[model samples]
Target: MLQRSFYERPVIQVARELIGCYLVREIDGETLVGKIVETEAYAGPLDRAAHSYSNRPTERTKAMFQEAGHAYIYEMHTHALLNVVTGRVGQPHGVLIRAVEPIAGLEVMKQNRATVKRQIDWTNGPGKLTKAFHITKALYAHPLNERPLYIEEGEKGVKIARSPRVGIANSGRAADYPWRFFERGNPYVSTFRK
Candidate 1:
């Protein structure tokens, strides 16, 4: 598989490229893989919904500046979510990997997920994906070029649909931007309808 070009484009572009990529994680000598199916692009300092809006460079958001193709993991209300830092070094922008469809090590995912049905629960949310994959703060700023954290081309990428992202009612017009992309009818997608 071709390694993604970290400097190819902005967060929106990167977000589109990210669809159908495989997010690989290694836990306890076992490898878990999931196909990227959903994503949301948060672009520029003017993007009010972005973590680094207005170029606010706090500790939690500093990862947004460490070039693209790096993991930006953060906690939200005691839940860990993952984002891919994108754009150039000085540009504070990223694409939040909202959800994924587990493809490998599903038994591990089931064990991590407990009894939440075989579908609709494996990796449909940011926090859920982390829980299912055993991802945490330890993976923060982890280089995607290394093992246990790299993304690869999935088995025949799917066509992505663009729509406004879920939640973010405080971002004004930015919240309405159709930057979210997802596979059609994929059970692992964040939501079925736009």
Candidate 2:
């Protein structure tokens, strides 16, 4: 598990470095693991696309204001999107976990995502990855180093690629910011790869 200091860095740095980290989920005694392949930085307060923009701390985004290394799950339509709260306590920065490559508990992940005709589709999107890992609102504000969900160190020499974040065309000039990062040629990366 990574220390709190690891997540207390700048949002963009955390997002980029998270590219090759391992996201682990333990549910019902089964351990599900995946290599994080895609991430997007949300520079809170000033980022129009971030839920914590304007320093607003509503019930849904209150976790964003918590200390770094906490889970900040939010709903998109009916699906839950998982984010890692980064930066200091009063800073609402975060890193959205967009996609992951399944590494362990493949059978359980397939069972969770029943329509997964191909392995890549199991975690190719934020919502899909959350579903496959059983992440939900219940995990909001949970510490990333604690039980059910946590992150572990992964390979050290991975090459990361950067691009504009996905689905935020209305964020003005922030929409063009190259805050999205992913493993260079990983097939399990999201379909929006650039």
Candidate 3:
């Protein structure tokens, strides 16, 4: 399990460093694991693309104001996206886990995403990844170091690439910020790879 301090740093740093980390989900004795392949950083109120932009705190975004390392799950359209809260209290910074490569419990993931015909498609995007791992809004504000969901250290020395975040075309100048980070040449990265 990663220590709380691991997520206490700046959101951008945490987002970039999360590449290659293992996202583990232990449910009903089945331990599902995946290697984080892509992430996007959302800085505090200053970042227009962030849900907490302008210091706005709605009931849905309440988890973002919690201590670092907490889950900040939120709904987008019909899907739930997972974010790791970062920065200090009242500073609503987070790192969105964009994609992951299956590392364990492949059969379970396949079962969870049975509609996905291709193996790579199972966790190639944020919503799809969360579905495969059974992550939901119920996990909001849950600590990342706890059971059912946690991040563990994975392979080191991974080369990373950065680019503007995906699906934020209306964020004005913030839309072009290079906050997205992904493992170089990782096929499991989202389709928006740059």
Off by over 4 Å in 3: none
Give per-residue CA lDDT, model 3, range 1-194, as digits (tens): 99899999999999999999999999878999999999999997999999899786799898899899999999888788999999898899999999999999999999999988999999999999999999998888999999989999888999999999998867899989999999999999998832
RMSD for all candidates, in order, please: 1.8, 1.1, 1.1
TM-score (all chains, Cα) for each model: 0.93, 0.97, 0.98
Q: What local lDDT score does residue 62 receive in model 2, on the 0 to 100 scale?
A: 91
Q: State residue 12's C-alpha deviation in candidate 2, in Å.
A: 0.6
Q: How far is candidate 3 from the true structure (C-alpha RMSD, Å)?
A: 1.1
Arrange candidates, best lDDT first: 3, 2, 1
lDDT of model 2 at residue 131? 95
lDDT of 1 by residue, 110-170 (tens): 9988967765687998889989988899889887768777787675658888899888777
Candidate with more favorable, higher TM-score: 1 or 3: 3
171-194 per-residue lDDT for model 2 (tens digits): 798888999999999998887833
Ten contiguous residues minimizing lDDT sum, candidate 3? 185-194
Q: Model 3 TM-score?
A: 0.98
